[model samples]
Target: MSLSIRNQIAGTVTDVATGGAMGSVKVSVEGGELTAAITKDAVEALGLASGTSVVALIKSTEISLAAA
Candidate 1:
């Protein structure tokens, strides 16, 4: 099935965790924080850093809005 999502947001890498088998990257975009589980090898391949620029492809159905 095709999803209806407008992936039009760009984000920057704020933090990265690579201690485990898979690397986890945190990005801040549109006044929000998003974390994605990426491959450790890919993290190293992309050379991601604290200030690295990244794109957060927003999958609408995959996103959940909540109040804190």
Candidate 2:
């Protein structure tokens, strides 16, 4: 089986709440190195949770990254 590996920055779920009809996922990457806000539905679909193990995909084409 071929496994799809995404370039992810591992972090913790900082917060979670409702956004109108959708939800929100705030993850702190790299020891609070980076924070990203994702949709709650996507979080639920991905089975994400507070203190849950997650992968933050680093999309090169769409977004850029920097060294801090």
Candidate 3:
């Protein structure tokens, strides 16, 4: 698939938490883990689960970084 988003990270799904009408998906990226909140329907359509390999497409206008 072709996407305009340039921040695509290949990773493995670490966890999936679904409740209400939203779902939180965690992907283990190169440096750390990336969590995305998406609709439950989208989650089901993607068939996301732990250990599933996927590409995380990140498209944002602003990003905040913190020192840990």
Candidate 4:
């Protein structure tokens, strides 16, 4: 598939938690893990599960910075 998003991270799904109409997906990446919130319907539609290999696509319009 073609996408305009470039910040993609390849990882393996570690867990999927669904509640109500929302869902949380955890994926193991190179040095750490990442979690994404998605719709429960999307969780099933994409067939996401543990050990599933997928790419995490990120497209954010805002950036936050804090003084160190």
Judged by lDDT, which candidate is best?
Answer: 4
Per-residue lDDT over 20-59 for candidate 1, one digit per residue giving the tens place of the 0 to 100 score = 5788999998879889888899899999989999976666
The regions of model 3 sitting more than 4 angstroms off are 60-62, 65-68
TM-score of 3: 0.84
In candidate 2, which residue pairs clash? 23-40
Q: What is the C-alpha RMSD of each candidate to the true structure, in Å?
A: 3.8, 3.5, 2.1, 1.7
Superior candidate under TM-score, 1 versus 2: 1
* Candidate of highest TM-score: 4
* lDDT (0 to 1) per candidate: 0.84, 0.67, 0.90, 0.92
Cα lDDT over the full model 2: 0.67
Cα displacement (Å) at residue 33, model 1: 0.6
Looking at model 4, report the run of 10 residues with the lowest lDDT sum. 57-66
Write down the TM-score of every candidate: 0.70, 0.57, 0.84, 0.85
Rank candidates by TM-score, best first: 4, 3, 1, 2
Q: Kindly indicate the candidate among 3 and 4 with the higher TM-score.
A: 4
Instruction: Please provide, for model 2 over 1-68, each residue's C-alpha lDDT reduced to its tens digit, 9 standing for 90 to 100.
Output: 53354466778776667665576667777656445566657767877667876767666565776898
Error of 3 at 13 (Å): 0.5
Worst 10 residues of 3 by lDDT: 57-66
What is model 3's C-alpha RMSD? 2.1
Ranking by lDDT: 4, 3, 1, 2
